[model samples]
Target: MQPEQLMLFEIAPDFRDHKKYRDGIFKTKAQLKEELRQLGRDRIYHVLSFGGGTQSAHLLEQHLQGLIHYDYIIFSDTGAEPQFIHEQVTWWQHRQRACGNTTPFLITHHSSMERGLEEMLMRYIHTDYQRFQMPVYCSTLDPVTGEIKAAGMMPRQCTVDFKIIPVKQAARRAVMELNGLEYRQQMPENIGFIIDIGFSYDEIRRINTSQSPQFKYMRLAYPLAEENLSTADSIRFLEDNGFPTRRSRCYLCPFNCDGARDIGMDWDEIIEAEPLSFLKACWFDTELRRVQRSGSKIMRSIPYLHYSRRPLVEVFAAEYARISAAYRVELAEWVSSWEAAIQEKWNQDELLIRA
Candidate 1:
């Protein structure tokens, strides 16, 4: 074979082997570990943005103070998570202590800076008079045509407005305190910081395209992806460490499709676990549906959540109904109460507007 032909033949097989490049352009674990060792760990301050979810717990159990030393671990609460999640967070705190780490856990919230998800939902429905548009990417089933369709939402600023900004602020504060510097001075120019996010190997696309911290002094790092670890690996690590896994998220977060069933938290399970919180979710859904109906120039055959284009309550109720008769009855009661509560809130809002 010609030299060019031989080179082409050697390269052609790799194109079909998708697994070889599954992690994109990042270095392997060994390469990353060596690079870290070379960087002289003393100079780098690590700040873990702990999500308090399964993936985050896995990351913490595997990395924080165990394999990697971090200066701080921060959790941003939007003031919308269920009590069960908070309990798990408390457990996580104790677990971290037991693991022989004195790194302080910082709990921050957007409520301190701006309105949280609950207030945002209330204003979106009662005051702002804006439509709840569906995310353009996700396809939803059309009741009339019995086909899946896609649309767009206004914009998903919640992550940036609520989670990212608050967490970054908290991180900055933590770093400042650690260095014993006053807030008036600019952050230490010589020091480099790593914002350790917990994206796993399965989410390689995110690892590749995700933006670094906008701040010049900070850089984003995903150790899980660098190590080529997936959710299964995370779960195994948690099990091996004897720590229970729990998903931490806002109760009404629209991103939670199928009611967060991926983390074993379907809508039925949520309602059964926290009936009051479930009612709040239903009420929130009702308001978003109202906004959609009022603002959409086009009529939608199906309803959706504040974020989703699909009907939230209807879809969740359908899933719950399939499980048990008693569950269905409870679901009906919750829906009725949610609707009534929404109506009362709407009336009160209207009265305030007229006044």
Candidate 2:
């Protein structure tokens, strides 16, 4: 049964209240600086975890203008971002060259799933892979009443798995290479790292910790938050400099807002700019529920890409129909190519046991 679609405005007040609570728990810039200083490493490498978005671009521009310094600038591709975001990354790379900034700009992806989120989703749909990473909205069915009610959202682990961790690993490997050490060698105790994220002041709630769980010698920092800059401020700064200001997120990110919400992260923009990716999102939205209902996966609650806990296709029926038809062949080829890749990568036969 399809769950009822709730409007964004109906939920905005609750989100606002939650944000108010979260905003208070974050550590201030002074605290972060003091923590880094306490690490007391002989050398600290500063890295920018560039997201190819407005906030990070603002920081990158600062670096280009000699306002800041970074040992590395890294972008981790989730393999699901729209082409426009990729173009924006390239645009910034060109800008970097034009400014004669010779910082090592690197691109990396999830260590296991090199294709990142799309590969993960495809494996979930096609195989018995159960490590679901997306923060999909979920609903549960009331068996007695035959009604579906909203359950809480799944954990948003993809950001760590596909984005943050990849950047960390790449930065670690890059540093290792620079020091003439093998990838698997233990890091020298004298060296430490501080990777900067692009969370703005208004997005402080998103800042959970400054410590890196995977690497003891590394710490996470937020330059934008330290400067008390909001996302809007970054966008304004980019506009003032005639730079691209598109929000960088996966094409099927659950956080995408509708046009009515007027947030910069809108699905309408995706539909217009990258119709094929939009169709792929709709495909994932429908296939996820179908696979879940098939009883092959452990996730009991029905998952949704749309915020209303409804199918994305239904939410944008007209657009989906039009775009799906327009890109039918391309979509089919995409599906076929992914299926082939999944079979090659994940469907290996088990070794036979000898008696």
Candidate 3:
């Protein structure tokens, strides 16, 4: 049954993670069947927000044949993920199609100019030194004594613009395609859709129903949280089902992996596999530092992607040198034809998909 969107707000109060409470709040199978029995099967369209990452993958697997069947699996590419992630998503799409799944897997994304995080940071925002602030670790001194103190990131706007907005737009088009309606037309209130996210029990802090897009035809659902699942549980499920269990994320993101080893290992692998992308990340770090340098008074150190605040290139200088030596030809290609390469390899087709 299509649960009332407002019911989520009431039953699952802010920060309510109790299993018994959640179980009681959510409808049972029989109850769901009864509630949805009167509606046509196609009345409610389901979407899995496939971020090409671990949690979203878990959600995709979980709702494969559930009562709330997904009509579309949507991926919003920021055009900055490692080549491996793109390949994995392509493989998944083809595999699902080959298996004859009726559900369509669709990829949506920002245009090249607005795609990569680094490009956006370089182009749009500037670091304000006088207003320079750190959310976490800043060395601050007494204001009267001219002391210093310690803060957080660039902007989460990248996610909103690249991922959230694009996904919503794609989902709307997918639903329109299914119904033979114009993409820009308003969705009928009677036609419900659920945007299933991959947030898990371990990352409850990241969960917020209010942050979801508000649409009369759409609502957000967190299956992982409802089922009390964690990343480890998702990994086990994928392994048991014989699906790929790789940690899916943007290669250059410092927040990509969880632990220190995994984080270091991810960077190490990227340094070996995609040197140009690594260099670009370093360029991004350097750009931030440049902004820091502009404000001589507040500039003690440069902000960086890594926790160490060292430029990416410096951290893996040896790896960079090795790759430079091994792939001299490719390194040249990176300088002379890199933009063209991205155009050829990562250029996206029109995102709208119809059944």
Candidate 4:
């Protein structure tokens, strides 16, 4: 890589050992740990623990032990994360305190500059629901075959601007503020900050590509990918460990897919509930909204952004009894395995504790 590219971008291999980089798509626990261990022991760097714990994949309950050595973690809460996430955060707070640290897992990013997902959609896209077409059934025509697969409502945009963009800004501010590092400015050269992200190896391409002068002063470390526990394995690990794994989803996210077996709505409900939301939020031009009245649905039922780890299953059931029962036996078996792992960690890592 040339110096110019290093300043502007840094490209790395997309695949290792002839396999696509393992991101959320696939990975294992033991590999995930090794990734963290290799992340380094630098104190100047900061490891950001992403908040949205969609099935205990968030940094707190999932990767706390792997994160302590770094500096700070800036978590931007959209106030839309799943309910069980709140519980894991509470437990993580206590664990951090016991280990002589004070950072709360919940870094609620509140601001006078608050923007609701709905309101942002209207401001950016400049459209009203009454003016645009809504999908009550299936697609008018299929891409390959002219057949209607399913049907429902269209989606809106309350995620990108309200959550993704804002969080990135907050992360920038957190780096600049640095608790008190700005005033001191006393850190040594070549030992400046590193920003540790939760993205796994599968996401390495994005992490590598998502560079800017702003986020590049700090070197990056990916503990999860380094360890090899990509997204699928992380969920599998949580399920195998005994802790409740599903039903942990955001309250109003636009990216829900696969009719989450445990929590929240599928693409159908999301699109119907907030039509033309993304058309507006995507913001093609400041002067017009008519051209942007696009739909977020795939066929007639699914939201385009709603990707699923498993097959379609009703996500939000006012009554969750049936869904809860589906995973009862499986969840119990998983909990037993985690309990055993936790025990083994305590028994075997005593010397590491002192270090």
Best by lDDT: 2
TM-scores of the models, in the order given? 0.68, 0.89, 0.70, 0.47
| Per-residue lDDT over 124-154 for candidate 3, one digit per residue giving the tens place of the 0 to 100 score | 2232213322221223336598744334444
Q: Can you write out model 2's per-residue Cα lDDT over 1-355, one digit (the tens) per residue?
A: 1233245433332322334335644444445556656766657888999999999999999999999899999999999988999999999999999999999999999998999899999888888888899999999999899999999899999988999999999999999999999989999877888888998877867777777899988888887766667889899999998999899999999999986776799999899999999999999999999888887788999999988998989999999999999999999999999988888888785211110
**Order of candidates by lDDT, top first?**
2, 1, 3, 4
**In terms of TM-score, which candidate is strongest?**
2
Candidate 2 residues lying further than 4 Å off, grouped into runs, are: 1-40, 349-355
Candidate 4 matches the true fold with a TM-score of 0.47
The Cα error of candidate 4 at residue 253, in Å, is 3.8
Judge candidate 2 against the unseen true structure and give its global Cα lDDT, from 0 to 1: 0.86
List the candidate numbers ranked by TM-score, top first: 2, 3, 1, 4
Model 1, residue 99: what's the lDDT? 69
Q: Worst lDDT window (10 residues) for model 2?
A: 9-18
lDDT by residue (tens digit), candidate 1, 1-355: 7998678754543312234245444444344334444555335567777877777787676565477767788888776777778887888899878867788899997744353666555545545334332222234457698786666543456655566667777887777777898755687655656667777766655444222345555556667766666777787878787777656667766555454445444554466677666666766666555545564324343345434464555666753344434455665675566445545555564422212
What's model 4's overall lDDT? 0.40
lDDT per residue as tens, model 4, 1-355 = 5797455433442233213333332233333334434544233444454554432244444445654454454555554444445665555566567766655343634352242332222222322222222211122346688664434345332333344344445554555465445623543333334444566554554344222233333444455665654566566666675544443334334344433342233444323433232122122111121223244212223222223211122232322334335545654564355334434433353221112
Q: Flag regions of model 3 displaced more than 4 Å.
A: 1-42, 65-68, 111-114, 125-149, 214-216, 256-265, 295-302, 324-355
